[model samples]
Target: MRGMTNTLTIGERVAWYRRRRGMSQDVLAGLVGRTVDWLSKVENDRIELDRLSVIKNLADALDVALGDLIAEPSLMEWVADSGTKTIPRLSAALMDYRLITPVSSPSPIAEMPSLVSLAQEVDELWQAYQASRFGYVTTLLPETLSRCQTAVEAYDSDDQVQARRLLAFTYQLAATQMTKIGEVELAWIAADRGLAAARITGDPVAIGSLLRSVAHALLAAGRFREAMQLIQDTASYLDPHLSDPSPELLAVHGTLFLTGSMAAARANDTDTTRTFLKAADESAQRIGQDANHVWTAFGPTNVAIHRVATAGELGNVQVAMDLGPRIDTSALPMERRVRHALEVARAYSSWNRTDDALSTLLAAERIGPEQVRYHFLSRQLVLTWIKRQKGRPSSTLADLAHRLKVLD
Candidate 1:
């Protein structure tokens, strides 16, 4: 098994680790409360292990880090130096409390990022994120967050409120990016910070928008029940304003419903899922057009996209296959489009349409390579395809896997 870590599939790695630990298949299987036959099929890669909870159980049984079995290549290996340094700096920025109290002498006001420039840059970063330019956003996030903190302290009255709003929005973006890359704990921290800032602004729209981030991080961390509760509570809190809602408020409310739908779907609560989806659709109809108000991308088209996604999450692949292809996603942002494409690919994979699945994945990569590269769905689908391949994978499949760093 020497040097196999870089090339072995997750199942193979599990086998290697089990053997190295002097454990039998029966012993390992019993430890994880799985049958030996199930363990055998898992080791042979006959079944793909995609669920994080199941993988965590296996890792615990094997006495390995979850990353050891997942083997996701470092972001730096694919993007560059920024990956190694970005997270720590972002953490420091998140932890810095100088804005709350003078921890040390603050940077000179002249040295701080100007409010006007910071607002513009915040919008630009959100645009970059929606366009799936994640690596670039990660590189800039630490400094931008620090600047928002500084702006809150430097300004006063209305300017301070505006600064706090920007700070909340920036933290929302950070939480979103962290969730995308599997940094769930950090994502939660960012979401908490965003919500705290939003509360200080006393803006319902700002608070509502941060609720989306908080719910998103919760979903990523598999806390579906808590996520749904938060969404429901936020929706109730914003209900009074919806009678004569601004576009921003409508978008934020609609986005909260969409997140709720996802949480319900993942929790396998069909009734709640339908209810949330219906609410999202009603909000979309009221909005009248596809728009990115409050950066929620809430509209009829986005609601449709989420319907397909929720179906996929609930194992209604037939519905996803039926709805996913007919919808024109060209009008949506690259993030939503790529995400829908990945769901379509998942539908195809589950339907055993390997060729269609691979083609869809390839097309999604062409449009958003970074998004596909870091996404768990794409990685698992590609790994399953590799396992299902007999003699050897075609050059295209091999190339994609190599580029995704699933193979050394």
Candidate 2:
């Protein structure tokens, strides 16, 4: 049944679960405030279930866990791809007693890492993540978390504040990486921890940057409204500082709007999406060029990339196809480049350009194998192509599916 469920599209999964619940299409449609015709089309995959809120509604009516409908990857699958104990160790690091409890005295332990050394480690982790080296990042994250926590505990005065800033950045990295791998709950916890650490540092730039992580976590968890609200409020708070903003502030602020645009698109709020994108574009224009300050990837080119993504999310396949393929993302991080390619592939698949979609996904896989394999969109699209094939799929398609483990 697990394998069967995985092989089914989301709409097919809904139909399967409805049958298991002994409910008719009419009955399920009524439960979800829709017509029987609408339900029939949904079950037939004639309609796309792209909105999270709608998906959540369907899951609620079906009385199944959200993941049961989404076919989220299992713990064993993640471990198989990411080496043994990666998820559990990261979870353990988040739950460490030392991090959670206040220490009265400095215990006998190895000397605390210097602030410079710790900062370098944090930067390295960010670099690994941006390169889509998910396995390596996960392997190194638990120890980095512990080391940063130790630095926070050992430093004093101004140094303590700096250590806290680094700790916040580390947590933000964990949160973002967890989201990419579909660990939404763990991502939420890490985002919250990063926000807490940023608060202690009293650095508006740090706090604002971590807020983007929090927003991403919320977006991953399907809390689209909460995510957008957080972004709006943070933007308002940071507006006064933009008169003569630091590069870090500009990048963080622009990235926040970009995230809000995505959340808006996911919620099917086209007006808000446009508004957020406009603000982000204006911010980027002020910055004048592509840059990765604060690891926000906030710049003109990045804004253009988000435009392609939001267009795809909003179901404007033409717009995505027009904008996505033309953008040269070589200057951006490998993670961002791969993500844009995935969006472009989605556009191609939507337009029924399956060969082009397959080729695009193959190219992205070559660039960021971990990103493509673990990403829900890539896996789903591959499964869909396989299901649509009348006989055997093409060799390259089959190999791609095998590598993604979607055929499992």
Model 2 spans > 4 angstroms off: 1-5, 30-38, 45-54, 63-66, 76-83, 102-107
Total clashing residue pairs per candidate?
Answer: 0, 0
Q: Which ten residues in a row have the lowest lDDT in candidate 1?
A: 73-82
Q: 1-408, model 2: which lDDT tens digit per residue?
A: 333435677788889999999999989999889999988877776665554567767888988766667776655244344677677888888876655666645445588788898899999889988988887788789988888878887889999999999999999999998888778888888999999999999898999989999999888777788999999999998998999998888889999999999999888789999999999999898899999998877799989999998888778888999888899999999999999999989988888898999999999999998888877678778877887788999889998888877675
Give each model a TM-score: 0.87, 0.93
Clashing pairs in 2: none
